[model samples]
Target: MFKKFVLATSLAAMALSGAHAAEITFDEAIAGATVFEFDGDGDMVVDVRFGTDDPEGFNTVGPGANQTYISEPGLEGTTLLDTDLFVEFLGGAVGTLSFGFATIDPDTSVNFTVYDDNDNVLGSTTALATFDTGGDFPEALASVSFAGLASYATFDFFGVGSRYIIDNFNGTFGSTEDRTPDAVPVPGALALFAPVAAGLFARRRKAKK
Candidate 1:
């Protein structure tokens, strides 16, 4: 009875830990991939549309983090300005979200806005000095984070003469059972569970003897 109880508890804890966060590095993504449903859900995770008429949506991956970052296509001479990247959380609202940002232009300020499920603005933030040639394009990239229950977010690069990119997008889901396809079990919880499981097995062996 004790062994069964312990086993059940340990499995429950691991299950709970597995559902807290979801992340996307975009390494597995193709250069022009538009939608990213990290959890394999039909819901739209990200929409990379540039404008209404441009069908070549979803900018190609940038030259950073092993070419894993999503970059702005060369539209400098075109009519496109103040380009924005949108990420939608169609499953449910997330408690927090963060991403890495880089730009070719120095001291560029990028604006981020979070919206609730109703499309109401929840909050906003501006990240500056995204790229200073500190190391490489993605190295030393600016880290931007927003705290709130958000259903979607937009990153705007207004008047940025050069190109910019974002990678390592992460979100903490509001529901503990919400998770992504690549989401892993929490390391701390796994460590704690290992000993408990071992002890339970040992106790069961002794009881059998």
Candidate 2:
């Protein structure tokens, strides 16, 4: 009985190990998606909130040198002025974050604000992401690292009348997958195995009596 319990627990641990810091390259078929969620650990979750500034929201834009990337098309009849993305980490925090971004105009800039778990501002930065003649809009990368763990972050396009796109999200948290439209939550495998292990323990105790 003990051996069976140990085996079940080990299998569940392996499943949980699958959750790790993930980098999103925007290579998947996420043409018309909005919210991207990543299961970092069994207890926490990470969400890259996007698609709030334009009519097209978050969609694949081009097949440039870097292939397809995510962007918000500020089409007509839209009040959207600037492109923005919010990365929120729930139940946990990270110390490092990086991603690639680009703008419609050359020599555009982007602004970032990072916060801690208590909603306190940790640091802010402005990165200049230029348009490459050969690569796509996401040709330049923006990276940030702080001494304290970060709970959330905000990125905004600072160029006047210009929009931006992002791709290749690298972080120090868990990994993620292409979640088009909606993403279903997946906790650690231990949640599933816990019940089985408990049942087995109960049976073993009864037999011992």
Candidate 3:
């Protein structure tokens, strides 16, 4: 009986250890601190800017103007600003991308795509919302998996050209590499040896008698 108890305890410990593994959060990701400029390639220009009109005027664009243009002429139709943020997971595990965006035109649709380092689209989603017209902000969230991705090195975010005001943009990737262990009882293995343990115990009890 003591031996059986020890075996069970060891199994339980193993399971618990597996379940308690640590996982990487979005903030811990290396690409989390990166901020990409839309249309910074000087190819196409878009009339969009970021930041408040506070005294600090901490805007992404130059002075006097609240909007910045892509300035790229080749990018005429469907102007999209794309940035490649590299992220790598050491272990081969499932990973997810979580992101949220606020837009001005609630009626217009926006497309978000996740791409590998090679520029292949792994996943994409489009959000359509009714225009508030009152200038209120509407938010949307999307998540994607890292399975079958060309490479885990980089992910891309493509913003569809529209008068969309984006704020509070955040992204996070989660992985199962840090899942807590599950204590699964090995009933089959235990049953296979149960008869032997029972026989030994009976023999010992008979000797005592």
Error of 2 at 111 (Å): 0.5
lDDT of 3 by residue, 88-159 (tens): 322222234443333333444455555555666666666543323222344444445444432333223334
In order of listing, the candidates' clash counts read 0, 6, 19
List the candidates ranked by TM-score, beginning with the highest.
2, 1, 3
Which runs in model 3 stand beyond 4 Å of their true positions? 1-94, 130-135, 149-161, 165-209
- Candidate 1 Cα misplacement greater than 4 A, ranges: 1-20, 33-36, 40-54, 65-80, 130-133, 138-148, 174-209
Clashing residue pairs, backbone N/CA/C < 3 A, model 2: 20-174, 20-175, 21-173, 21-174, 22-174, 22-175
Q: Which regions of candidate 2 are displaced past 4 Å?
A: 1-21, 39-55, 66-83, 131-138, 175-209
- What does candidate 1's lDDT look like per residue over 1-209, in tens digits? 99999988886885665423455555444444444344422133432222212244445355543322333221111113453566666554444456666656555556777777778887777666433344344322334334345667766764443555566565554234343433455579899999999999999999999
Distance (Å) between predicted and true CA of 19, model 3?
Answer: 12
lDDT of 1 at 17: 58
Of the candidates numbered 1 and 2, which has the greater lDDT value? Answer: 2
Report the C-alpha lDDT of model 2 over 87-130, residue by residue, as the tens digit.
77543345556766666656667677788778788777777765
**Candidate structures ordered by lDDT, highest first:** 2, 1, 3
